[model samples]
Target chain A: MESLLSPVILFFALGALAAFARSDLAVPEPLSKALSLYLMCAIGLKGGVLVADNGFTTELFLAAAGGLALSCLIPFGAFVALRRIGKLDATNAAAVAAHYGSVSVVTFIAGNQILSDAGMAPAGYMIAVLALMETPAIIVGLFLARRNAALTFQPRQDLLRETLLNGSVVLLTGSFAIGLVVGKAGFVPIAPVFETGFTGLLCLFMLDMGLLAARRLLHARRLTLHLVLLAIVFPVINGTIGCALGAVLRLDTGTTTALGILAASASYIAVPAAMRLALPKADAGLYLAMSLAITFPFNITLGIPLYSMLAKLMV
Target chain B: MVISVPHRKIEILVDAPLLRRLRQLASEAGVSGYTLQPTLGGDGDQGRWLDDQVTGGAGSKVVFTTIIDAAGAADLLSVLEPLLDEYGLMVTSSAVEVISARS
Candidate 1:
C-alpha cells in the first residue's frame, strides 16, 4: 500500500489519469528527451560512484551474465507460449516474443524510482545489464521469426548499427562510463541537479510516459484476450524466475528486484523498430498494443511492487 | 523555358522501416531520384497513428515519393507488387508532365 502511494508513482498515476480523460496536458518532446538524458546520466553517475566505493568484484560479472542469459532465454519461453497459447503463426509469435524478451529503458528508470522509495539502491553496473539485455532478444526474435519460412525480405544494412547505437543505449552507457570516471568527488558538483532535482525531473518524465501509455492504450482493439492474458502472465512467470536467478546468484535485494523488472519488461521502442525492419509481415498492431498498452501499464502500476515484494522475500 | 517530358510520380505511405528497401527497389527500377517525407499521423484501416510520439512507436509512419520515366515506373510496380502483399503499404502513381527546365 505504501509503495503504491509513492509521490513519483502518484505523479505517474496522475499523468495517466489526465491522459485517460483526454486532457491536453503534455510534455514537450525536446524537454522530455532532455529529462530522460538527465535521469540516465544521474543514474549512471550514482552507480559509478558506488562502484568506485565498493570496487570491482566477480559479482558484477555474474550479474551481467545473468542479465544476458535471461534476455536470450525469455524469448524461447515467449515463443512457445505464443505458439501454443496465442496460436499465432511463426512470424507474429516471433515478433511478440522479441518484445517480451527485451528490456524497456523507461521501465528500468521507473523501477529505479520504486527501489529508491523502497530504500534499496540498485547497482550501477545494472545499467550494463540493461544495455546488454537489448540485443539478444532481437537476435533470438529474428531467428524464431525466420525459423520455418522462406526468407525474402532482407533488413537494411544499418539495422544492427541502429540497434547497438540506439539513443537510449548510447546515453545510458555513456553516463555509466562518465559516472565511473567522476566517482564520488565529482558527484558533489553535479549533485544539485542530478541528486536533489532528480525526483522532480523523474515526475515530469513519468508524466510524459503516462500520457503516451494511456493514449496508446485507447487503441487496443487488435489485442485478443489470449494475447492480453499472455502479456500479463509472461511478466509474472519471467519475473519470478528472474528474481530467483538473482537470489541464487546472490545479488543484493535491490539488484535482484531490478533484475526481475528488467526480465519482465517488454520493449516497445527498440524491438518494435527492429520488428518493422525484419518482420514486415508480422502484425504490428497486435504486438505494439500488447507491449505499450497492456504490459507497460501493468508494470508501472502493480508489477513493480509485486516484484519488489518477491525480491524482499527471496533476499 | 521548360521541357514537358512524360513521367510517373509514385507515392507510398509505409512504415518507416520499409523506406530503405523501397528506395533500393525504386533505384533498381531506374527512378531519377526519390524523396522521403515524414507525416505527423493519419487514419488508416488499422486505426489512427501518429509519428508525434518519441516512443519506439514513432518511427513507423512515413511517406516515400519517387518519380521515374513511365516504363521504369511500371517495372518498379512489378517489383513492389509482391512486397506490398506482405507489408502494410498504400501505393499510388499517376502520369505527370515534367515541367522543370534542364539543358
Candidate 2:
C-alpha cells in the first residue's frame, strides 16, 4: 500500500487517468525515447557501480544461471497455454510466448525501486542477468513456430544480427560494461545525474508508459478474455517460479524480488521488434495487446507488490 | 513554362522494423531514391498506435516514398506483393508528373 502511494507510481496513475479521460495530455515522442534511453543507462551504471563495490560472488553466478534458464524455458509453458487455452494458432502463440519469456526493463527498474525503498536493494549483478535474459526467448520462439511447419524455414542471418544488436540490449550491456570499467571512484563525479536524477526521470518515463498501456488497452480489438486472463496468470506463475529459484539459491530478499519481477514482466521493446521481423505472419495486435496493455499495467500496479511480498516469504 | 515527365509515385506505410526489407525490395526493383517519414499515430485493421508509445519501433509506422518510372513501380509492387499481406503493409502507387531533371 505504501508502494502504491509513491510519487512515481502515482504519476503513472495520473497518466492513465488522463488517457482514460481522453485529455490532450501527451509527452513528446523524442523526449519519451530519450527518457527510455536515460533510464536504461542510469540503471546499468548503478548496477555496475554496485557490482564494483561488492565484486563478483558465487551468488551472482547462481542468479545469472537461474535467470538464463528461466528465460529459455518460460516460453515453452507460455506457448502451450497460448495454444491450448487462448486458442491461438502456432505462429501467434509462439510470438506471444516469446514476449512472456523475456523481461521488461521498466518493470525491473520499478521493482528495484520499490524493494530498495523497503530496504532491500537487489544485487548489482542482477543488471547483467537482465541483459542476458533479453534474447534467448526469441530463439526458442522461432524454433517453436517452425517445428511443425511444412514450409522450408531457412533462418535468416539478418534476424540473428538484429536480435543480438538490438538497441536496448546494446545500450544496457554497454553501460554496464562502462560502469564496470569506471568503478566507484570514477562514478562519483557523475553520480548526480545518473543517481540523483534517476527517480525523476523514471517518473516521467512511467507516465508515458501508463498512457501508452492504457491507450493500448482501449484500442485493443484482438485481445479476448482468455488471452487477458493468461496475460495476468503468466506473471503470477512465472514470478512464483522465479521467487522459488531465488530462495532455493539462497539469494538476499531484494535480489530475489528483482528476479521475480523480471520473470513476471513481458518485453514490449526488444522481442516485439524481433518477432515482427521473424514472425511477420503473427498477429502484432494480439501479442502487443497482451504484453503491453494487459501484463505491463498489471505488473506495475499490483504484480510488483505481490512479488515483493512473496519474495519476503520465500527468501 | 516548365516541362514535366510522367512517373509513378509509390508510397508505403509499414511498421518500422520491416522498413529495411521494404527498402531492400525497392532497391532490388531499381528505384533511384526514396524518403522515409515517421508517423505520429494512426488507426487501421490492427487498431491504433501512437509513435510516442513505442520504445522499440515495432508498433510504430513509417512512410516511405519514392518517385520512379512506371516499369520500376511495377517491379517494386511485384517484389513487395509476397510480404504485403504478411506484414500488413499499405502500399499505393499513382501516376504523377515530376520535373524532368528530378525524374
Candidate 3:
C-alpha cells in the first residue's frame, strides 16, 4: 500500500486525473520526447556502471538471450489469441501483438524505482536486454501479416529496415553500448545531469503520456470491446510467464520482479511508428489507445506491485 | 486559338489506406501525380475531433489532385464508389478550364 502513495505513483495518478477530467494541462511534445531519450540514457549509464562494478559474466548473456526470446515469441501467442478468440483480422491482430511483444521503457523505469524503494537490487545488463527485445517481435508480426495475404510484395525490405533501425531502438541500444564503453570514469562528469533530474523529467513526460492516453481513450468507443479486454488481460498473462521464467533462471526477487514488469510492458513508441509504415491497414486508434492508454497505466500503477509481490513469493 | 478542355478537378477526402490506393489508381489512370499534406484535425463518421495528438492513425485527411479528362474522372469514380461504400471518402468534382494540357 505504501507503494501506491509514493511521489512517483502520486505524480502518475495526478497526470491520470488531469487527463480524466479533460483539463488542458499537458506536456509539450518535444519535451516529452526529449525526456524519453534522457531516461533511456540514464538507465543505460546506470546499467553500464553496475556491470562495471560487478564485472561481466556469462549469466548476463544468458539473461539477454532470454529477453530476446520472450520478445520474439510473445507476439505469436498473442496474435493467435487475438485472431482466434478476439476475432481481429490479421492486420490489426498483428499490430496489437507486436505491441505486447515489445517493451515499454517507461514501465521498466518505474519498475526499477519500485524495486529500489523496496530495498532490492536488479542486474545492470537488463538495460542491454531491454534494447535487444525491441525489434524481433516486429519481424514476427510482419511475417504473420504477410503469411495470409493473397498478394506478396517487396514491402518486407522497407519494413525490416524501419524496424531494425528506428529512432527509439537506435537511441536506446547506441546509448547502452556507449555507456558500457565509457564505464564509470566516463559517466562521472555527467552523472549530475542524467541521474539527478531523471525522476522529475519522467513525471513531466508521463503527464504528457497521460494526456495523450486519455485523449485516445475518449475516442475509444470506435474500438471493439473484445480488443479492449484482450489489452487488459494480455499483460497479466505475459507477466505470469515472465515470473515463471525468472524463477527458473534463479534471478533475485528484485530482478525477477523487474523482469516480469519488463515482460508485461508493451511498446507504444517504435513499434507503432513502424506499424504505421508497414501495416497501413491496421487501425491506429485500436492498438495505440489500447496499449498506451489501457495496458500502460495498468502495468505501472497496479501490475508492478502485484508482480513484485509474486516475485517475492517465488524467490 | 488555344483549345481549352473544360475539366473537373475531383477532390477526395479519404482515409490513409484508401488514399494511398487512390493515389496509385490516379497515377495508373494517367493523371500526373498528386499532393498529400498532413491533416491536423477533422470530424467525420468516427465522431468529433478531440485533439490531434490523441489519435495515432492518419485517419486524418489527404487531398488528391489531378485535372483529368471528364471521361477519365467518371471512370475513376466508378472504381472508387464501391470501395467508399464501407469506408470514409467524399468525392466531389468541379468544372475548370485547363489550358496547359499537361496538368
TM per candidate comes to 0.90, 0.96, 0.80
The deviation in Å at residue A309 for candidate 1 is 0.9
Model 3: residues with Cα > 4 Å off, grouped in runs: A151-154, B1-103
- What does the lDDT read for residue A147 in candidate 3? 83
Model 2 chain B is weakest, by summed lDDT over 10 consecutive residues, at: B49-58
The lDDT per prediction is 0.82, 0.88, 0.75
Ranking by lDDT: 2, 1, 3
lDDT of 3 by residue, B1-103 (tens): 4667788888887654345557766766667755666554565554433324322323345666666778888877877764464444677889989885443
Candidate 2: count of backbone clashes, pairs at least 3 residues apart or interchain: 0
Which pairs of residues have clashing backbones in candidate 1? A269-B56, B16-B60
Fraction of reference contacts reproduced per prediction? 0.34, 0.51, 0.05
Give a tens-digit lDDT track for model 2, residues A28-121: 8778889999999999998888898889999999999999999999999999999999999999999999999999999999888878888988
Regions more than 4 Å wrong, model 2? A149-155, B100-103
lDDT score of model 3? 0.75
The DockQ of each candidate is 0.40, 0.54, 0.13
In candidate 2, which residue pairs clash?
none
Q: What does candidate 1's lDDT look like per residue over A55-89, in tens digits?
A: 78787899999999999999999999999999898
| Sort by DockQ, top down from the best | 2, 1, 3
Model 2 chain A poorest 10 in a row by lDDT: A148-157
